[model samples]
Target: MASFDVESLFTNVPLHETTELIVNNLNISHLDKFGLDKVHFRKLLGITAHHSVFCFDDCLYTQTDGVAMGPPLGPSYANAFLCHHEQDWLEQCPLEFKPLHYRRYIDDTFLLFKHPSHVNLFLDYLNSKHPSIKFSCEMQKDNQLPFLDTMVTNNNGIFHTTKERLAWEPRLTIGSMREPTPFHEARLVSGANSFGRHCQWVTGLQVLRSQSLRCSHLDFVRNTGKRTIIERHRATRC
Candidate 1:
C-alpha cells in the first residue's frame, strides 16, 4: 500500500478552469435537485468561486490561480475538482497495476496495489497525470502507514487498524457538563464509539513482532477513560 498527499490542494487548483469544467460536464436534468437551471447554476458556481484577493505581508499583493483557503466552500470545491481530475487517471490506468483498494479523504489518498513490484511505476504514473496537482507518497514501512486517524497495517496479507499518533490528542468532551450544550453529550457518545471501534480492531492483531500494544493504544485507553469517567461524574452532579 502507498499513500500520498496533494500539496497545497486549495491554493494550487485553477478555480475558474475547474468551475468551467464542472459546469460544462454537469447533467442538466439533475439541476432541479438544487432548484436551478443550467444558466443559474453556472452563474451561482462562478459567483461563489474565489477570484483575485489582496494579501499583505510587508506590502499588498493579489493571489492568482487556486481558491483562497479559510472559507468552508474552498475545500468542498477543490475536492470536487481534484476528484474529477483523478478519475481520468484511474480510468486510463493499466489493468496489471490497478489499485485493489483506493481510499481518499479530501487531498490525502491511500492506494493498495495487488502486485507490490509495480507500485513505483504506478506511483510515477499517478504523479504524471496532472502537472499542477502533484502527489507525494509515503513508501510502505514494515507494511504499515498512517491514513486519516488510523494506522493501516498489512500483516502478511491481512489488514489491521492501529491508532494514529497525531500532533494533538482527541477530546472526550468539548465542554463542561454545566455548559448546557448538546456538544458535550455528542462528544461523550462519540468517545465511547471510538473506544469500542479501537478495541474491536486490536482484539486479535499484534502491533509489532514482539508486542501487542503501542504507546498510542495505552494513551487512547488512559485518556478516553479519564475524560469519559470525569465527564460522567460531572453529568451526574448536574
Candidate 2:
C-alpha cells in the first residue's frame, strides 16, 4: 500500500482546470439548485480565479494561475478539479499502475497495489498528469501505514482498517461517553490541535465519529475483550 500527498494543492490548482471542472459539475437543469445560469457562474468563477492578488515583500502581485487558498469556494473548486484528473487517470493510465484499493481524503490519498513496483509507476503517472499538481508517495513499511484516522494493514490479500496505534485526545466526548476523534475527519481536523477551535463545524462518514472496531467483529472481541457494537446506525464498518 502507498500513501500520496498532493504538494501545494490549492495554490497550484491551475485556474483553467478549476473553472472547467466547476462548470462541468454545475449542471444547467439544476438552475433552481444553484440559482444561476451556467455561463454566468463560469464568468463569475473566472473573475474570482484570475483577479486574486496578494502582497509579498511589500509588493502587490496578481496571481496568474491556480485558485487562491482563502475563498470559501477554494476547497470545493480544488476538490472538483483534482477529482476530475483522478477519474481521467483511472481510465487512461496503464492497468499495472492501477491501485487495488484507493481512498482519498481531500489532498491525502492512500492506494493499495498488487506489486510494490507499480507504486513508482503510478506516482510517475500522477505527477505527469499536471505540472502544477504533483504527488509525493510513501510505501508501507513492515506491512502497515497510517492513513486518515486509522492504521491500514495488509494481511495476505485481505485489507484491514484499525486504530490500534492511532493518536487521540484525552478529553473528547460523544453523547454520554467520552472519546476522541483520531486523524483526518475528511481533513476537517487534518492539522488541528482541537477539533472545534482549529477548524469549522463539520461532519463526515461514521468513521469520523467512531473508528472503534475493525472489519471483523470477531477480531474486535479477541483484541479488546468486549462485545462489538454498532457505530452510528450501521453494523458494518465504514
Candidate 3:
C-alpha cells in the first residue's frame, strides 16, 4: 500500500492545455444538440479557466500559473485533466510495473504498488509527464500508510482504517481559538473518487467529526466512497 499527493496541484495545472483536452473529450453529439460546437465550447472553457482573480492577505493577485483553488470548477477541471494523462500513461505502461489498484480523490492518490525497486521509477515517470505536476509518495511502513486523514492497513486483500491527526492540525488550535468553524467549512476539503480497473479490494470505515456536524450527512469510507460499513467487503465497482 502506498499514497501519492500532488504538490501544489491546483496552482500547477496548465489552463489552456486542460481546456482544450476537456472540450475535445466532451461528446460532440450532445454538445451539438445544445448549440455548442467544439470550437465555441473550447472558447468558453478557455475564458472561464483563465479568468480567475482573488485577493489574499489584502493583496490582489491574478493567478497566471494554473487553476485557482477555491472556485467550483477547480476540482472538476483538474480531475478531468488528470484522467486524460492517466489514461494515456496506462495504455503504454508495462503490466508488471503497473499498480494493482489506483484510487484518487482530487490531488491525493492511494494505490497498491508492490514492487519495491520500481516505486521510485513510477514516481519519476509521473513527474516526467508534465513539467509542473509532481508527486510525493509514502510507501507502507510496518503495514501502514497514511493517506490524508486516514491510516490504512492492508492485510492480504482486506483493509482497515483509522483517522489520523496531522501534525499541523495541533498548531491550528493555538491561542484559545477554540470556536467551532461553520458547517460549510467541511466543503473546503471535499471529494470522493475511487478507481480500480481489475482489483478486488476490501475496507473498513469510521467517521469522526471535530465538532458536531450541522448537516444530516451520509457516511463515508476511506478507500472507497460507497459502502459505509466498517468491515471487510469488496469495494464498489467504479
lDDT of 1 by residue, 55-91 (tens): 2432323356687776444755676677677777777
Which TM-score value belongs to model 1?
A: 0.63
Which candidate gets the maximum lDDT versus the true structure? 2
Residue 167 local lDDT, model 3:
67
Candidate 3 wrong stretches, greater than 4 Å: 32-34, 56-60, 164-238
Report the C-alpha lDDT of model 2 over 91-123, residue by residue, as the tens digit. Answer: 787886688777675677878788999999999
The local lDDT score (0 to 100) that residue 127 gets in candidate 1 is 84
The segments of candidate 2 whose C-alpha lies over 4 angstroms from its true place after superposition are 162-238
Better of 2 and 3 by lDDT: 2
Q: Give the TM-score of candidate 2.
A: 0.63
Off by over 4 Å in 1: 29-35, 58-60, 167-238
| Residue pairs with backbone overlap in model 2 | none
lDDT of each: 0.60, 0.62, 0.60
Candidate 3 structure quality by residue, lDDT tens digits, 1-238: 7777899889888998887767666666656555666786665554455756443443334477598876566876677678778767756667766876777767777777767666777787788888879999989988888776677887877888876766665322112211112222122112111112101121111111212211212334333464332222222211
Residue pairs clashing, model 3: none
Q: What is the lDDT of candidate 2?
A: 0.62
